[model samples]
Target: MEGPRASGGRAMTGRSGKGHRDENFPVASKLLRPEHRAPIMAFYRFARVADDIADAADLSPSEKLHKLGELRRGLDGDGAPEAVALARTMAERGIDPIHAHELLDAFTQDVTVRRYADWDSLIGYCRLSAMPVGRFVLDVHGEDRATWPLSDALCAALQVINHLQDCAKDYRALDRIYIPADMLAASGAEAEDLALTAATPALRDAIVATAARTRTLLEVSAPFAGGIRDRRLAAEVAIIQRLAESLTARLLTRDPLSERVHHRTVEAVLLAGGAALGQLFARRRR
Candidate 1:
């Protein structure tokens, strides 16, 4: 994990399309432990802002790169509002700045690089974009490397799944493609095939294969549930695992190109509740 330091600045002002400070903090709500919520929210806000800057359609490559550099400087204590807030939250949580920086590197890469030559290159992007975030979460829960590696695999798999789902939007808007070129070529699919109203058999098959690979990674990392000593944290991991399983199932059933598949609000609640209860029951039996 390597990247820029967060500067000690104030919270970012002004709202974009969604005029909410906490919109980007996906998992930060009453659901999490009160003590952990604020810091995690702040971290998500910081990452979201960085991502927006890198991915904004309005900005030119130079502008995006320049802003990212500024963000990097801010992370180093340059005193921008978001940077300042993130720096404080990170310090309070004792989160290593390296993960924050690594994320910046990932966003920077997104702004500059649009295509990956092979699976290895795509995996390398996952290392910067996804693995560090998982490592940071494990660190917050006081987990060690034994758990970190598997957690990272799961996180990277999640990222890959997300990329697969967002392929259409990413290509049409951001001019980015996370699908490996070689894989597409081998399957006789093209980037243009992703924008089709329905997935061709080749494209469908490619996505299914990719989903299977991600599922394998999740399976390898399944034992992570037992490593979390905190009950809440264990529940969180279980919920994530269930979500991954659900996403994989959906990918197998539907063509990702035609319609996006997602867990509905009720479905999400059911899955999370069921997973948490299952974990609690297992612990009680133990």
Candidate 2:
């Protein structure tokens, strides 16, 4: 029997329907042009399914690794439905399959590893887990090398911010800690500090410092928002930056140990509106 076509049969629909809704879809859907939305959604769905496989707590690390290997084969045009769907999208968009592969490799690492020893180690993880997402987004937007470094900075910073925000939850549930173990040790903080009912001065100081570092990275990437020629793309970048700024501010004000900080719906709407207005002004200036 002939193998299923890479873009046809059950293979074309892929693994997207089997798991959690693609987390990136909501953000990507909002950011992409209407015509581009379907392909972007498909890409996010493919990535999300791979992520779910790696993140499934019920699966042993060996099982996750095996699944990830299958995912990699699928990316290579083997007839796995999700991989086929993803490969078809990549074929149409000129997206590098290497990026998708890198993401799976990262997910596999996460399943096997639980803690980062230092900032360098953490950054190594980001290079695999976070930087590829930025590259994927840039590929979707048809951005070139001139913008990639900045996009990587932004994506890595966002990943770091997410780690800081989810520190407690990830520690409690996954035994994963994105914060450098060395830093925590050096600060005289223990893993137990994250579980405290209130933020101790040491823990609070560490988190605040990390948030500041993320803010610096975000600032470095800010100019790229203005560099994009597409209005909606510019708005998307602006909105993300504004949200980061807002989150950073919230982090600064809240007791991280006692209160989880998150942007409220109304705050998000206003920030997005403000970002759109800022983008309009930027375009007018040019």
Candidate 3:
């Protein structure tokens, strides 16, 4: 549990992207009930470590995969500190281990798969990588399985938004690419265009086009806020949905290759607060 935190000894100064705790998007944020935080943080820690392993430019591909394999072993009760913490937390919270395992499946893909053939293929990756976070949270709150499809849409949208924001960084730092190949072909663009200091018209068009696709997921996820059984979780989900859509809107306008697309702290606070107010009104009407 503390092992990962103890061994690194490196302080996260925010831009390093060196740890999961340094992540820009929310995970286990304050919206959840107090009791749920521990398991969520543990899960985030495990995910962060695995991401670190995959993104380690100094490590060879084989070396990175081997570290990821250790994380996989944590599911079976033996792995690194983060994985062990995840296993114990799952057992304690009665949370299923499958979500974490599925994440590993995606991380393993990161070690090998670089190009996506089509939209469906890319979504197949999201089913493993992005969808699990939502599923696990629902499970922690004891929500029904019927909500998963809507949750999947929201989660996948959030995931895609992250990819779009980091397209340039992913290409430069991790040598990873998540944009589907077919979409780029359709736009007469290639992934290399993202590596430039500024996005070419073709690359910007491709991202704008992709943002349209991500928006469809948000549109389909409209029912997610109401589907949750817990009132508190409903509010939190609403806030996240709002944030995702807002960021997506920015994606459609911003030059991600050169300009920042993420919300500042004050902007995010306002967005989340607005979502909370909307949820409150919706609940009162119901």
Candidate 4:
């Protein structure tokens, strides 16, 4: 719901994606040190705005694709200010531009692909849409390459969680469905069920099953918490991991059609505090 107001062009203002806290988990939040803000924000601005374009209800598929291409061009040094800033940051940090490019690939896919055929297909989508984010963060911190597999898993899990949370909205508003077709069939459901005002029992069962699958991904990626070198980042990942786990559990048993499933403010504060205290004790051990 925190998407951009425009359908296309350079009409997007910085105010559009400047400080949205709706990422479900912390992204560019205060948990990170101040110095990390600008660069992270630069990347976030480009990605966030691009996401807005892809999700814009008023834009045609061709129109959305064009805006996404413009973003790519900006990264190549000839587009919007947000993309230019992102390009400059990537160059100065010696981070490869390919990571940002990966997101472009996904956005383009969003323009064309409206439904996922199966889990492998969905994960393939995640490789482009999600994995780059974790890779970008790792590159920013200069973390070791060995940690990438776990990071990839965690990021992919987060992506799936987001997809599931917005499943109803995505279907109704954008005519997109990230839920796998196979899973829906298994539950005696179809993609059309998502457009209903209320989720039927079979539809809810399928969604819960998918949530359970996402939870397994989080478990596999849990070790990534210890693998991070930056204490703040580690704490951040810990909080995210915890939040993702909590959200998935809620999704697994709840009816996605009838209610919301998310962490409240006090819950977020507690999770962050737990992560920070965890880092404190971790440092004492070191």
Q: Write the per-residue lDDT of candidate 2 for residues 1-286, one digit (tens) a residue.
A: 0000011012221232442221211255355598565666666666666666665656667876787787778887884577788888889888887777777778788778988898778878878877777677667778776887887777777777777877776676567778788777767778888777787787777777677777888888888788876677777777877777777777777775578676667777788788879888979987
Residue lDDT tens for model 3, 1-286:
1011111212232112545334555667677788886787888878878766766666777887888888888877887878998999999988889999988888788779888887899899889888998898888889999999999999888878888888877877666677888888888887778779998888888888889899999999978989888888888888888988898999999998889898888998899899989998899898
Model 4 C-alpha lDDT per residue in residues 1-286, reported as the tens digit of each score = 0111122222342223434465677886676777675677788778887877776666778888888888999998999778999999999999999988988898889889989988889999889888888888778888898999988888888888877877887787677777788989999997889978778888987888788889889889988878788877887888878888888988887666677776789987887788768766876787
The TM-score of predicted model 4 comes to 0.91
- Model 1 segments more than 4 A misplaced: 1-26
Give lDDT: candidate 2, residue 285: 89
TM-scores, each model vs. reference: 0.89, 0.87, 0.91, 0.91
Q: lDDT: which candidate is best?
A: 3
After superposing all C-alphas onto the true structure, candidate 4 shows an RMSD in angstroms of 3.5
lDDT of 1 by residue, 1-286 (tens): 1111111121233123332232211254354577776666566667767777766666777877888787778777884567678777778777888887888899889878999888789889988888887777666666676788777877777787778877777776666778788777778888888778888888887777777778888888787777777778777777777787788888877886787676677888788789889988988998
Worst 10 residues of 3 by lDDT: 1-10
Local error of candidate 1 at 213, Å? 0.9
lDDT of each: 0.71, 0.70, 0.80, 0.78
Instruction: Name the runs in model 3 displaced over 4 angstroms.
Output: 1-21
**Ten consecutive residues with minimal summed lDDT in candidate 1?**
1-10
